[model samples]
Target: MESEDITIKPADKGGGVVILDTKDCVEENLRLLGDTSTYQMLEKDPTLQFMERMRGLLEYGKERGIINEREFKYVRFPRVPVFYHLPKIHKKLQKPPGRPIISGIGSLTANLSEYVEHYLQGLVVCLKSYLKDSIQILNQLSDFKWEEDMFLVTADVTSLYTVIEHLQGCEAIQYSWQCTLF
Candidate 1:
């Protein structure tokens, strides 16, 4: 396996290609965590209390009928997070934002979020379909009908995710699930 990233491209015709340094990005991440250095330097073994907390959450889900025993049958231990960055390219920004969101597919919270991941993609598709009609998105329209006297307006939701409380979010999920299932 390759340990480091290497790029070979055509000769930098007048202007050169800037891969951009990852050190600044790494420093930003460490700063956000208030750590002295990279997160790997501080990574430690999972504590017994951490295991207990995860087990408690799983048991609570079972009690609430949110998850079945079958789903947890093959899950024994939580996995540690393996962090990787996906480079982000923006049209207007001269330099890459460089600060991309790190996704932990193999982290301690991964198993606990396995079920949530099931909805993440489906929610995106469903939301796209719903907004397609309401927002009058051209390509997503199946059968577009236009009226002469119609005026269209788009609404913007500000801080919808950040402002919503956990309980409210859960209630919204529960209500939507019930409506879809029944």
Candidate 2:
């Protein structure tokens, strides 16, 4: 009786590609190098522990006359020592600049609260000083005999916040605070 041939199927469409197992490949390459007498000696010797493989490459290059004594000295000594001693220079010279535009007006108003109170106090003091001078002037003009006849006209600003338009109020507040409102 004749047997049918078996066929293999591919994996799912979205599944990743399969790669070759490199463990055995690397182990075989290491085995080939381990067969040498120098490699065997390097494995036994504690002095040749760190750069055993690099020493083999350097010896091979020297035997091939690809690197001379002078060239190897400069390559392995002077240039490398200079690189170690040099200080690490930063890329950017200075830190980034501050923001180009202002932020919230509310923040500005909040910060100016104390200053505003101080300013109002100063203004009130100045107004009181002026009033005293004006009273003195009026008393002098009235010829020393003080009359009880006094008429004062006073005006009250009602609903100052609500009555003023938002944009105009902001501008006025900014002017009073001596700052730009955002």
Candidate 3:
């Protein structure tokens, strides 16, 4: 296919590339977004609203002395996030499927998100199930005391990304944060 009429994306599973018809790529993306329970089509961009909400949250932090004046001033409105997809070539679908990716590198709440992640990093690291990398897993396996009846198992949650609702996610964060204080 000609470059102009095709879209090139990295494969979701193994390392490689998948070149697909641009129309097909667009349709696949739209189909993923068409999941009403997970996503909704907005008539207008929500950048301004998001920026304002972020500002209000920051202002509240400032008022409560949770944030200093310098930090409040330093955190400015950020650019909106960009949405794209990587082709899930490993899937056995009729048409080429894609995994949606909403990049929030410079989005309105990006800084706040980064701050929250940093704050929670300590707790996450201390969790018994936390795995830093494949090497860590290998180290654990090397020290494992296997029993005759015991079987090692692994699992992959395919729908993990779309399974949790936003409110549920926030509640989970809040719960984690509260638990950390004790």
**Highest lDDT, which number?**
3
Using Cα atoms with residue i matched to residue i, what is each candidate's TM-score against the true structure?
0.52, 0.18, 0.84
lDDT of each: 0.53, 0.38, 0.81
Q: What ranking of all candidate models by TM-score puts the best one first?
A: 3, 1, 2
Q: Candidate 2 lDDT, tens digit per residue, 75-115?
A: 22111111001111122112211111123233323323344
- The residue pairs found clashing in candidate 2 are none
- What's the true lDDT of residue 21 in model 1? 44
The clash count of every prediction, one per candidate, is 1, 0, 0
Model 2 spans with C-alpha error above 4 angstroms: 1-108, 128-150, 154-156, 161-182
- Candidate 1 lDDT (Cα, 0 to 1): 0.53
1-182 per-residue lDDT for model 3 (tens digits)? 35778777788877497778889888988888888877888999988887888888899999999999987876657887888888877774446677888998877777777777777888777666789998999998999999999998889775686788889988877877677778
Best by TM-score: 3
Cα misplacement distance, residue 64 of candidate 3 (Å): 1.7
